[model samples]
Target: MSNMQTLRFYVTPSHNCSYLPDQKAKTLFVDPQMRISTDSYSQLSELGFRRSGGHIYRPHCEGCNACQSIRIPVELFKPSKSQKRILNKNRDIQVIRKFPIMDHEYFDLYKSYIDQRHADGDMYPPTPEQFHQFLVEGSIDSWFYEFRDTDKKLIAVAVTDHLHQDMSALYTFYDPAEEHRSLGTFAILWQISEARRRGMNYLYLGYWVKACRKMNYKTAFRPLEMLIDGHWTHYRQE
Candidate 1:
């Protein structure tokens, strides 16, 4: 069957937009009954979709085009002076990739991250159930990349998905107290480097809302690409 015949989707009712304030948003999601495969998800990702937990979703909001899917063409990405600085600073931090697993230590770091950084967001009070559901039980290709300090103290966790030719960064949380170390930026830089090392083509960075300051970091990676109006276009801020 063709895509038109095999694919099933539903539009969510308008809800408060998470990326933008005072605006309502809707999402178009693939029916779980479809039992989407990693291959199918890769195709959807190129079409500007993202995976959250076990569901594939994209912003289908009406009258708003603020949400744009962003990716880093691994081979073409060149770090800026600031990024280079971040890399140098985090040289002591060790990165380890593991199959997604549930551990109390990870959840504890998650709780502290949410409490300090995401207090106003939907995940304010992070829970064990939500953590496993969102990061662990999603798909077989999922991985948990842990970042630890020189002393072996876990400092950050980056949830990622491995695909045929690329990897998607699902979510990242870190010790909010380590603000000066800039663990968030370092995590993304590490992922891009890892993707190149693994011979992956692109590293999907999820949605970026230009107006949202929290998302501005996604644009820092140069020679970036954004799926716009069904086409992927390379962009670089002057």
Candidate 2:
């Protein structure tokens, strides 16, 4: 028996749903900070546990099913010429993996990302403590990938989790000052590379909202499979 095989779970009370308008949402979470094995984490992910911060959660809302778990099939991933160019453009950036941490620099970068990219959003001007709580205090296999330049300037960071068969991208933010670099796309490309290196087949990109321009970029990744009605349907690019 592996550590991940152990059963541990908790349910959250209904909260105002962030995804859909006028819908209440509840979540069932498995704390990764608890004494769970890596095997269990993989099992939970297959069972629909999406990592956020340090928590693994599955939708448990009553009667509402707007939330869906999504993953990208790495075997079929083929970078377009433009994506390859973006990768080439960011060739100088270095990615370092570290246990998630809350610090002044990270908080500042987060604030800058929010202010520039999501000013009218709920996370606008998030307090340091709040940012820490959201990014650090959770239960599950989570880590942060920090992207830096030659001078070690922090350009971007992505908090993600490793599951048995896949990697789940939790949240990512960048300096915003380096817009020309397209850090968001670069980060996803890096995750794909990391996933291939880890021998994982999937990279779980949370969701793709058709109506949201901010989310529309996710569709640009080739050979992605969107979760539809509990099935991963292949999406082809014309």
TM-scores of the models, in the order given: 0.95, 0.85
- Winning candidate number (TM-score): 1
lDDT of 1 by residue, 1-238 (tens): 2243488999999999998899999999988566767777888888898988878899998788999999999999899999999999999998888888788999999999999999999986789998887888757488899999999999999999988899999999899888898998999999999999999999999999888999988888888998888999987675
Q: Which sections of candidate 2 miss by over 4 Å?
A: 1-13, 31-34, 236-238
Q: Which residue pairs come into collision in candidate 2?
A: 3-37, 4-40, 31-139, 32-139, 32-140, 33-139, 54-139
Across residues 173-212, which tens digit of lDDT does each residue of candidate 2 receive?
Answer: 9998999998998899899889998999999888654544
79: Cα error in model 1, Å? 0.8
State the C-alpha lDDT per candidate: 0.89, 0.80
**Deviation in angstroms for 111 in model 2?**
1.7
Give candidate 1's error at residue 76 in angstroms: 0.8
